[model samples]
Target: MTCLFRRIRFVLPTCLAGVLLAGCAPNPEIATVTVPRAAQHVSPAARALLPDPNPPYTPASYQSRSLAAYYGHMQDKLLASGKLRQDTGQGVAITADQLTKDFIDIAMKDEYMRGGSGTMHRSMDSVLRRWEKPIRVFTVFGATVPPTERERANALVASYVNRLARVTGHDIQMTTRENANYYVMFMGEDDRMPFGETLKAAIPEIDPATMNVFKHTPRNQLCVALTFREQNGSPVMGKALAMIRSEHPQILRLSCLHEEMAQALGLPNDSPTARPSIFNDDEEFALLTTHDELLLRILYDRRLKPGMTQEQALPIVRQIAGELVGR
Candidate 1:
């Protein structure tokens, strides 16, 4: 089974244009906390490139520290068991046929479906989704995240943005919140509830069930991404939000970043057969592998337009996969 926390919702709310609204009411407690300038580690060059710095962060609560320790221990155990492999080339060999099948499974399916009651249910069905517009990512740090960690997260996200753009040959860049349609938020335990309110304000169409998941994400689930399409049932995505827990250790945090951001790009489901790939739930790869990059290339290829059903895109996918693998 896939990781329960790796959520992807393709929503088509009535208010599409207001999906990324401005002027969210700030939480008083969160607004009062501030980070000291000396605590920040962002270099001058990176500072100029990144979004405006977050307000001074509050110290982590005892519960938050305990949770971090638990996650850190879990990561160490996984690494010791050789499960979370960072080496992309270490996995099983791949072929054109396998790539084609994996693409259909990962790119053309939904992991979670929203019912009429707004509750998310686990269901699988073929659906082609991809962004037609330029992807502008904005990062938001929680009040409990220290400045040094925020700097590291910002740099990691910025680097990954460039990497994805190169892999897909698409226009993807990091931007300020004002211009960004994709929001990548790093929320600590203390920030989750308050941030949910902010999200509701920014996205008024956000349903109660979705807010419940965000505010009370299970501990086993580390991160999630939700993408929104136009109201007319268009497959082209216009907005996306990815939330990464601040309690994760460096490696796990980076892993969440890799999978969630890439999933938001369109490959929203996991397949057990996907080897050397982060899209699988086996935790075999902690980073985006060579095979995963090929998947992204295929997804964004000009020949395969967004919204093409699996039956319609399979032949083209097979041909493209063959060319990619030199079959």
Candidate 2:
């Protein structure tokens, strides 16, 4: 058998460490990527249903590390059975060439790796590294969600949670807010101010500016969300706060939810070449594809450690990406 992972001479790019580090007064900079809207999306039918009421108080949620770990193990039993099938994707091929290209494009680039004007050309392995720990997600909704809306969000979450678990192959589980590492939200149209405030309170020692960024939406972002990782004397673990505008069409909101959470898991970049994938700014696929699943698998693979540089992990990534394509 040929040894696929051989040592390579690639050097660690300069900025990746800063993106992954933690400390007070440490650069208040973190990679923030915009999930730009697809070139075009059809608008859903509008209605003037009963107005949504605001919450009496701004709401926030968090989980203890212990419970997050414990329940994550409980979820492993469910995810162990998930199989990424080649035939599950639409218009995507089951070939190694495409898989190799995707792994390199996604795993080795920063979120801003776009070429000048409509072409994606920036390239580097400066994307943040990995989580040394399991992550559990919990869903919360703004007061704007009616019983019917809550049912829709919760049902969608229930299924997406399983997919998240399978992709990470880690202790990625979903339970009530009491023990979640990630707090997913369904925000009402009127809840933007309260929602941003909730985020500022939920993350500790976060930048005032970063927190403030959440308060405003770019013209291109229909449903918006962001993820942050905190380091407690160890490599940081990701916690995401994802929200979809409750008043938007069901399909558009779901697309936002999918991209934000998945991007939070370390593959923070979007590549035009990634086909039938949620990572693309293009709204090509509504669900996770085999290609996307394999990328997540590579990120969480045992051969790659949490803080390893792209150069350090490249060989192992090559091996794992190849295996995912073949198997």
- The TM-score measured for candidate 2 stands at 0.67
TM-score computed on alpha carbons, candidate 1: 0.82
In terms of lDDT, the poorest run of 10 residues in model 2 is 3-12
TM-scores, each model vs. reference? 0.82, 0.67
Per-residue lDDT of model 1, residues 1-327, tens digit only: 112223244332221110001232121000000001111122344334543338578998998998898678767866765766787754578899999999998888655544567676665465577788899898988889999999999999999999999999999999976567777899899888876765643444456755676787766566766666643456677777778889999888898889888877888777888988988766778899999999999999999998798899999999999999877
Q: lDDT of each model, Cα atoms only?
A: 0.72, 0.52
Clashing pairs for model 2 are 115-121
Q: How far off is residue 231 in model 2, in Å? A: 1.8
Clashes of each: 2, 1
